[model samples]
Target: MTAVQLPELPDLPGKRFPRRVPVRQILCLVPLLLVTVVAVRHRSVLAEGFGQLRTAEWPWLLVAVGATCLTWVAAAFTRQGAVVERLPRRRLLATQFAAGAANHLLPTGLGASAVNLRFMTVCGVPLARSSAALALYLLAEAVGRLGLLAALLVAFPDALRLGTLLPHGAVGPLFAAVGAVLVVAAGVLVFVRRLRTAVCSFLRTALGEARSVHARPARALALWGGSLAFPALQATGLAAVGLALGLPVPPVHMALAYLAATVAVALVPTPGGIGSVEAALIIALVAAGGPAAVATAVVLAYRIITVWLPLLPGALTLGALLRLKVI
Candidate 1:
């Protein structure tokens, strides 16, 4: 005969209640909270921004929209450059659009990186190689953006004077914090042999992949050219918005301001750099000699055209791609 088991009794003298929290619920509400806070804090600015948008030049806004669209094409070209295998042209562009939606849902490009990684694997690229390609694409894009920024600085020395832009007191603390983090990271890598080995292997693969990609002139051109175009288009969109809002800053200065603001906020892990980017862009534009109210309006208009307007369609496309299993 089988015996039935009885439930165990609690050992505590009093009742023991579970204190578990809903972590997923908390996470879901965080972004909403941040958005609410930002909205309340900048309510007046947003009101003026909306007013400016209503009265803004339609032609310049249209140009900003066009530039925003071109960024997708640039992303597609950069993705094509990343791998030796040819990806379907239409699908590649669709993926970039979908990836943009994903990008705003997660921090520091994680969402886009995940989507692209999956796409590469679906296209029959090995995981290791795909990762290498991703690394190469990011490195190329960063270098291209910095190069563009440097060239602009050279061309317009007085446009965005860094000395006034960066706060005096923050520099030392920023460098110190960065140095401490690097030192700790280095210590961990030195102590953990397994992690060290894995990292070394990945680096080797990435270097080899980079070498092969550079050997092909077309691939090299596509990678660097697309990288350069992506940021240039982004800056153009900002500049167009500035024009639309009649910001006093010159077009070149606006472009430089865009580059400086974005580059500074790149390391921020906030989703789509929403809060941080808005703040940085406003500061940069103000430094570029645009009036505060006008700069706020330009940033809002640019974000609306580039981000909010496209978000829903991009999400729908993302769902379609997932259902079709093209990603």
Candidate 2:
């Protein structure tokens, strides 16, 4: 009888065991799965959203589209203000557009930040200066947003019924989360000597840059004005959608709702605040007295114009920029 030969096992270059599954990839997918489930559960609202789109007023929708376009311009101007070195105008604008697309791929604002940081360095800014400029930009943006929110809340005293925005008992969890973050941050600063030194150096550089930018009136105006306008334009876009869909909320109230929702979801680390933003916007709109179905429709339409519509063109632009070595 011929000796039987077992087929050779598939090659394993170095290990004796098969490759392990990617736990990190699977963990990242969990949030996406949760978003899908939420979407499925609210399929009815989304269907209503489609119906609302069919009957949406063309002129108001057009205005919303324009506002969305202006957001990129606002971002570009703000970016220019962040650094003293002059950036190429057309390339800067293109980078802002591409940054918007990149934003949805990573948690919080990291993807956009990374893209802009790279663009600055490629434009001949030193790495230390670019990092400092990024920090300054973020600082200005946060301050502008908070200032706007305060102004809106004050001017439209009854615009939002706060209780509706935060359901009973949510305040406790929110406080707890904030406390945990503070504790962790303190621990890091205390224990991580290298990280602490780096952070201190970065902060000193950022402060110097901020002072220099503010000393120039035009740069100061561009930095603060564009930062303020960016959020206002975003809120206006939402208001335009509300108008297009015939939501009952007044423009001022709608703006208030937009500001509140965005601020509430700002700390959420999900990519572009995906699930948190939608939920917060819907809740805020309802609190502002729009019907739930109509509010849902408005959020869906707003996101389409601002986030999804520009995504493809922005992505193509990113690829072209990469090929040209512009970023």
Candidate 3:
């Protein structure tokens, strides 16, 4: 009954166990890193935006900023309205602001959608239901935007000169292109059994959710009202910027121009529609009878207030949310 003894190993000088970083800590840093990269990439734009703000009227600029803030609220409401279950009000609102930053970082609306999807899932929603809710929100938003644009066009037919915005005979080709894409998409959907089945299942789920939402009067109102207000607020922000910068276009005309420009460039895949939005907006304002220089200034200033100014704060919020495991 003898115990075996082993020799003790000497510790090597300057040798230490590597400190492991927590994955959560690393994830939190990811958002901040992304924010830094984005800010550096668009430094010139950010500088120009700040420079343009100097010439803007303080009162109107304040209105633009207010509208920008409210857009996040509207988005939060719309997101809530999409799902039947109630989400925490403050966290939902904060997520929208964070989503705004994410939207600017990713192409089209993917970033915002991703953030919302993650939030919904983290809040205990099923993945399929969250996806349906996201689709419903998008559909409602699109309809609201288009409906508002149509109403404005009817109210002020002369607000925008379509010919100035589009090249000669471009309309026919544009429609044809859209139709071709739709036809191709339809063909694929029809030919692929698995895809068609999946789409049908998704559609059924989305429709069910939509019906459930509409059945609740309060939810329905929030859904539609928020959807409509989101675009209106965005347009108002642009109009306010136009006024602040002394753009010659009327406020209503500027709103109309904003709606038109956004709709036209909705399909462009650029992150937050950055370049395309600026160019489209400038052309839209010019078509709405604004001087080219003033139109450019208005668009730049509007973007500054709406996008660049809040970006850092939004990014910080996103990082905090990640650290807290909110999404």
RMSD of each: 7.4, 8.0, 2.9
lDDT of 2 by residue, 1-327 (tens): 999999999976875787899664554344344445545655765575556667889899999899989989999889999999889999999999988877865687997998899999999999999999998899889999899999999988998889988879999998999999999998999899999998899889989999888888888888999899999999999999999989998998999899999999998998777678989999999999999988988998888778666756776777667767787
The clash count of every prediction, one per candidate, is 0, 0, 0
**How do the residues 240-325 of candidate 3 rate in per-residue lDDT, one tens digit apiece?**
99989899888999999999999999999998888899999999999999999888888889988888888789888888998898
Which stretch of 10 consecutive residues in model 2 shows the poorest summed lDDT?
A: 26-35
Model 2 steric clash pairs: none
> TM-score winner among the candidates?
3
- Global lDDT of each model? 0.86, 0.86, 0.93
Give per-residue lDDT, candidate 3, residue 155.
98
User: Which regions of candidate 1 fall more than 4 Å away from where they truly are?
Assistant: 1-51
Better structure of 2 and 3 per lDDT:
3
